[model samples]
Target chain A: MAENRLDIRYVAHLARLALTPDEETKLSAQLGNILGYIEKLKQPDVAGVEPTAHAVPLINVTRPDAVGVSLSQEEALRNAPASASGLFIVPKIVE
Target chain B: MLHRLTISDLAAKLARREVSAREIMQSCLDQIARVDGRIHAFISHDAEDALAQADAADRELTRGVAGKPLLGIPIALKDVLAVKNQPLHCGSKILDGFISPYDATVVEKLRAAGAIVFGRLNMDEFAMGSSTENSAFGPTRNPWDIERIPGGSSGGSAAAVAADECIASLGSDTGGSIRQPAALCGVVGLKPTYGRVSRYGLVAFASSLDQIGPLAKTVSDAATLLGAMSGHDPRDSTSVPQPVPDYGAALTGIKGIKIGLPAEYMIGGLDPEAKAAVDTAVKKLAGLGAEIVDISLPHTDYAVATYYIIATAEASANLARFDGVRYGARVEGADLAEMYCGTRGAGFGPEVKRRIILGTYVLSSGYYDAYYLRAQKVRTLIRNDFLQAFETVDAIVTPTAPTAAFRIGEKSADPLQMYLSDIFTISCNLAGICGISIPCGFTSAPRLPIGLQLLGKPFGEESILKIAAAFEQDTAWHGQKPPL
Candidate 1:
């Protein structure tokens, strides 16, 4: 289990969430409880059963190469919150 | 006239030209106008556009074309689905004004079948929580009891069908979003085999687990919707290319079918009333000439833990796309980094942020093996347990939820408790099987509906539907409507 509070901070940073002190405390406890519950998986016995990733047996379902309709620039830009020159415009990246 | 009709009945009417597609769409719009304020099932209603589509269907019928099975029927799209030219807020403030450029494959199929896309229904902020309370727009109230929630993420779709706002609605089930709400609202919900339906235009929550299905008032209606919506879409790589079964043909009989009841699901922690209702349902199935067997899914208890780690970890990665750069809401700041932080922080609800953080942590470098990898390994075990159980049974039955829908704020504070609401339904997703939740019996407390879940082997939706249709035929459980 992840015991350190700093770990929560690090994860929060990765997620880009700014957590208040109170939120950090609450989340730590909640995450701890969840981890404690997950620890139950350590007790289940599976001697030789191989882990199965997907439920279905079949795989490699591929489609033939075909051309498809692409959305018109005007249609695509219709929903943009901010657009310029028929393109999605974003805030400047560099100073 | 169309308000009380199921999708199949509406189809029959459309086939006979007794009602034009425009008439059906108008009726649904009228119903929404009358009752939607109280139910709040829809976040966006496009009455004119729906009516125009209906007009086109009417024109097709007039030209003597063989109308599609769903021709002229009105259906609701969960806000999570991308409907072309409509704002797909996904019940979040961040994407408040974002409209989709193209239709989701399911939506496209529905339109091609002459079904009118009426509106976008409410959902949890990106389908995260069990209760619709996570919606940035207010929670959808249960049509049965105003004080309670319609079980959520897909709550709006379920509530809409229950309230007769739409004949049927499309909802995505990741961790029981469709079935739980359907159970709570006394409707029918089907979670098709994973990748059975295309997830092409769905905003990702947990990509591996998320599947869009239907919620309707009857099993046949759900089957109709499922049949119309499912197909291999090249846009979605995970979508299966298997032949689409005639879902309507599966409703024939359940005689001699073997149904398994996992002993692990029947133990402690289930609400007594809910359990009794499920027991009664099992007895009814047995009485209908179906054989019932006690089966053990030994890894059932670990499903919740395994599911959270995998789902959240996938969610963390999938949701990283919403960094305020492309579409939707963005909070401005001095620099790109601050803008990204401010945008996401302000845009996502608390639950979404919490899960994203948890998911990110689990998938982080050092912790990956301990959490994400182990969860994946256990997920394999979970899937194997189902595969092993299926060797002896045609389908497995359990309660859709451990308890009936609680009050709006009941489990909001405790995320674990909230996650447990999907305990009975999540394993089906993990195992990549088809499952359905149809109203089984009513609980004694609020007299809210209890759902009996039937889970079938992978791509075994036909068997599950056969059993569910059998149960519906023998009992009035599916016929009972919630008093709004």
Candidate 2:
């Protein structure tokens, strides 16, 4: 196994995911094998090669400021799991 | 039989008043009723809405109004693309009970082109897996053999076209999701050059890598669908302002085009039957006067590692919006943080959770420079390899997947083994180039289909469509239907 094995529980928390104990065990083993295979990336000498974030070079695109027709408040809240008075509802955070 | 006709043929019939659009839609609905029970290609479809659209198309035809190219065609969409008044689950439970209030840019274009966009096909959850097994609904079976998988995450799209459930369907590719399944299903699939099609309403998987394309029964059908679904949308900044080409007209011939064959792709793991199929396809291309040159893409081995790092990193960020607040399903907890974790834990499938964790770890503090940055630099080398090869050859050719479709559950136990299935197709997405897969031949024993992949340079859809059309014209492979 790779020496820098991932802390699955911590990573899951970082991703805002709650995993069962069985899931954590299985995922850790699978991800470990995948990372081990990825260690081959060290074989390539990519000195000074510019990283490509987008395959096509794109400039910061901006459009002219104008008021355009937009979705209605009703339409926006239509799919919300819980909403009231044109606002989405969620659990309390800073009570 | 009307359901089995290509888009071009169906359009001609509609134009000549030989068949009504409703009749064509009825044939498709009937076929879906007959075989979809076995193939499981669709997650849901609105038959009443489809008939209504067909009737509207018939009215236009009756008035002698010049119809749009895709007028009256029955097209399905992978669930990842939003359609107004339709459920958009993205093959995961996280999106439970959500309905889209607006159409994606591609959906609007399809509607504008007079296509009846109805069914939501199955896919790997968040487009994460190589086969459809990760779907929350259920896995779609291969049309060729019921026990085998339809290659995914566009498995349902390819299988629907193969089984003639609908005239054609749309799918997204971020790494080999579109072409791999198309290959395994023995149909035509095209992944246009990055920025070739607008991604404005697509659920973000890997924003930098995701592209929407067509899967169809014939190369020309794919061409027609691509034409309808392509062009610049000011809404998507990544959508290039390049003019859309009449791809249907690009099918002239490949009399003198140079097609490169990368030496690295003929690796040890490649199945012999698939290898022999590709070899024969090369000879067929040569017989049509296309020059086949052997080339080398030295960085081929690093693509899967590079793809997993970058794609998942993007995915981790894109998927953060699925938190319990705004839309979709929510599993409430005592606090906000607990709600977020609880909802995601209950909603996401095992594959999706694994990817999220891997992505979080790679992009975490102290690890970004090692894994994420290194992968991006390696990505540069991989892209350069394709660009350098394109300088000499117009396009490259390879087997779309390493082998034919395997039985379901064969590779699902091991994620690494499953990832290797896309080894031959992922480099195209990393390079931001256009690629197509067409049925080349078939395996004899179980009688499964094999695909030959042709990849073109950036903004080079015309070249590949032309080459694929020429190859498809001379071969009868695309004409063979699965023994459903």
Best by lDDT: 2
List model 1's recovered fraction of native interface contacts, to 2 decimals.
0.53
Candidate 1 is graded, for docking, as: medium
- In model 2, the Cα lDDT at residue B451 comes to 92
CA lDDT of B158 in candidate 1? 94
Error of 1 at B212 (Å): 0.9
Give a tens-digit lDDT track for model 2, residues B1-484: 9999999899999999999999999999999999999999999999999999999989988988774888899999999999999899999999988898889999999999989999999999999898999999999999999999999999999999999999999999999899999999999999999999999889999988999999999999999989998998889999998899899999997988999999999989999999999999999999999999999999999999999999999999999999978888899899989999999999999988888888888899988988888899999999999999999999999999999999999999999999999999999999999999999999988999999999999989999999899999999999999988
Determine which window of 10 residues in candidate 1 chain A has minimal summed lDDT: A1-10
Candidate 2 similarity to native, TM-score: 0.99
Please identify model 1 stretches exceeding 4 Å from their true place.
Answer: A1-6, A45-67, A86-95
| Tens-digit lDDT string for candidate 1 (A1-95) | 44423377788888876677787788888887777787776666655646555565557866688877898888777766678898776777766
Best by TM-score: 2
lDDT string for model 1 (B49-76, tens) is 8889889888988887774778778888
Error of 1 at B155 (Å): 0.3
Candidate 2's C-alpha runs over 4 A off are A1-3
Model 1: colliding residue pairs? A52-B380
